[model samples]
Target: MELPGGLGGNDAPDGESLPELLRSWRNRAYPREVSETAAPRRRRSGLTQRELARLAGVSERWYGNLERGEPAEYSEGFLDRLSSALGLGEAERSALYLRAIGRPPTSAVAPGSAAAAGMDLTLQQFLDNQAPNPAFVTDLAWNVIGWNDPLREWFPWAAQQGNQMLWALLAPQARKQLVDWEGSWARPYLGQIRYARAQHPDDEALASLEREILARSAEARKMWNLREVHEHADGDLRRLRLPCHRGREVSVRIVALRLMRSDRLRVNVLMESGRAVGA
Candidate 1:
């Protein structure tokens, strides 16, 4: 189905088109201090666009157009070809597709004031009550809105300076602190962000966050290319591996409850299960 902004019968007049809207969004996608790369490297690691085209089994010009964001027809097959050439995983492939379609990256989210206002106090109390279990609330962009003390104690990386979910994944401490850090937690959380991107294409904050993180972290860059989306809901569990505790693994269940008062926030409660206790 076509989204709210698509090149369908409801699009703006010929003079004002999707490209114009997309360019505007792209401009806003970058943070004030950051800028889009002037020239995206087509041939790096001794692999040229032509070589990549041959690998993907597509024409070089076509591949170039896709990267340049020029008007061109995109197919699932073409996307697969590009994904292979770029060595993109599920998250990275998804990110490429979103950018191609003029949508922001999954990791994109608002910071500071752009984040939705204060959450309900009752909700905060509810999150705090989840003790022993590691529960933290995040905005659309995955910022740490609320987290209990146990989480901080177990995963010191969780209580780092930035405390942003994405930052925790990129921070050096996280690798030493959490086990299976990439596959179990990071991937699924990225999937959630991708889902949000699909739902809110025009969300500047979300898109901006995605771009910034992609530029900063290689893990994030690789993950962004995969393009996976997972919904925030109940009964989701992730096992975290930590070093300080002999690389002990903790299993935590993620339960998400949406608030009607603020369509912008999702109150997530993470609870510990049998194996996760004392970790």
Candidate 2:
């Protein structure tokens, strides 16, 4: 059967037109049965172009032009809004961005007045409830925004160094405090920074942070040149040698959780092992 918008084939042809791809997606999303009546019956399962336009807060004509492959340039903001309206997941969002724009959407959300607002009260309370376990929250840039009392008590320098990436890479105390500074903390942290830099190549704040780290620390420059990337995994073990606790080493399990409503803010909790020395 011929699908609406001329997208009836079992699979999209190789090098299929962008308009065809959009139409195919729309037809699949909003499948309808055409009856042998004077007027073709329209079934409503998925969003119509008009509904999508309304949801995205754009003119129906503009959205229709896009589906029809009309020559039109769309802003990133518009594409992002459209993606949200379509209820696209991360992979779908990335595909939409790649098709609409030449590049994939950045993982780093645009910083604005919201950045000043910081984590939501509930998330802050969640971190605070971690209690004896050191817990903190950070934005995509790893800027320390919220922390529990245990973190402040254990790592006094954390209060001074607002950026976790900077402290891990540049601070002298970090090398002394972390058990496997190069292997565990410095290298992995540098890899994380590199990944963030890749996501927001145009962000001045992130760029400046990278520059500052490279300029201040020779080690960071060397690691930056390596161009390694790493993702933090939950339940990873990290050992810290606390100066306040007379050089006692403690093993802590890492627990990282992302806040969905906010722009990639993560809560990191360090649960001390039962065998942890210097409590």
Give the range of the ten consecutive residues with the poorest summed lDDT in model 1. Answer: 29-38
Best by lDDT: 2
- Taken over the whole model, the C-alpha lDDT of each candidate is 0.52, 0.63
Itemize residue pairs with steric clashes in candidate 2: none
Q: What TM-score, over all chains together, does every model reach?
A: 0.51, 0.56
State model 1's lDDT.
0.52
lDDT of 1 by residue, 1-279 (tens): 232345222222334433343333333331221111224434223345554444443456766665566865454434533443344445444445554665533332223211334555676676667776666665555545555676566644333212245445555555544457778667776777788888888975566556555655788778868987777647876666654346566666767777777766666655666634234
Name the TM-score of candidate 1. 0.51
lDDT of 2 by residue, 11-104 (tens): 3244555566666656555322211122554565766776555444345787898877766555554554455445455555555555555465
Give the C-alpha miss distance for residue 193 in model 1, angstroms: 1.6
- Per-residue error for 151 in candidate 1, Å, reads 3.0
Task: Show where candidate 2 strays beyond 4 Å.
Answer: 1-117, 275-279
Cα error of candidate 1 at position 148, Å: 2.6
